[model samples]
Every structure is written in structure tokens, then in C-alpha cells.
Target: MNVSRCDLLRWQFDFTWSLFDYHLERLQPADFLWEPAALCWTVRPDATGTWVPDWAETELDPVPVPTIGWLSWHIGW
Candidate 1:
């Protein structure tokens, strides 16, 4: 009945990722790229032509919504 701090953190992390994986299984390609609004963050090519997140485009005032691709990348990596 005793859990170390590291053990607790690991359990929480695992559970969170499990939930993420579950939902990820249900995502479609269109769902992954869906942008509810303009200026939202999502995955795209960087200046170097490597695929990267568009987090730099985000602003805090309006709290821009993130696309599923961005959420997936954020949680998966």
C-alpha cells in the first residue's frame, strides 16, 4: 500500500497516455488536421522542410485551439 513518488508519477503518466492512445485510435486523417479557427496550432513543415509543430503561431490572449494533430504530437512526443 506504499507508493514512491516516482512510482506515483509513472502510474499517472501511463494512465494519461493510455487515455490518449485510446482516443488516438479513433482519429481520422481529416480529424487530425481539423482546425476550428484561424491561427490555431497544428503540425506542419518547418522552414527547414522538416515536419514540426506550429506552436510558435499561438497567442495567449485568446487561447487558440489546438488541432488534433498538434495534440497527438504533443502527447505522443
Candidate 2:
């Protein structure tokens, strides 16, 4: 009963996506930009009106909590 590497990878991918889909389906529009804390990182529109994620050249002492939108953009980035 040996599973091929490809099969194992596919299974892993499917499982991961299922978990993501579960949360994704439950997300509300407001959840995307909801700041859970006073100090948090999120996406904001630039002067040109293009949305961008808050980022730092170097990691800060306290990593900022990311909003759902930031997390999503991060995953895609």
C-alpha cells in the first residue's frame, strides 16, 4: 500500500484548500478590512488609489496583526 509522491502531494493540496475554503466561505466583506487590534497591518489605498499592503523593509519588534485582506494579499503575493 504505497502512495506515489504525486498522489500524496495532491492529497495535501486538496486538504489544505478544503480548510481554506471553509474559512473563505464564512468570511464577510467587512471581515476583510476588520482591524482586530489598534496596532495591526492592513491594505490601504495609495495616493494613486491603488490598494497596497502595509509592509516594512525589516521586521518590527512586535509583528503587526494582519487583517483578512492583508492575509489574502500576502498569500497571493
What's the CA error at residue 64 for candidate 1, in Å? Answer: 1.6
Highest lDDT: which candidate? 2
lDDT (0-100) at residue 74 of candidate 1? 91
Candidate 1 TM-score, true structure as reference: 0.76
Q: How close is candidate 2 to the true structure, as a TM-score?
A: 0.71
TM-score winner:
1
Task: For candidate 2, write residues 4-72 as lDDT tens digits.
Answer: 999999899788767777898899989999999988999999999999999999998798999999987
Which segments of model 1 are wrong by more than 4 Å?
Answer: 47-49, 57-59
Tens digits of per-residue lDDT, candidate 1, 22-54, equal 888787889988999986878987789987887
Candidate 1 deviates by what RMSD?
2.6
lDDT of 2 at 62: 90
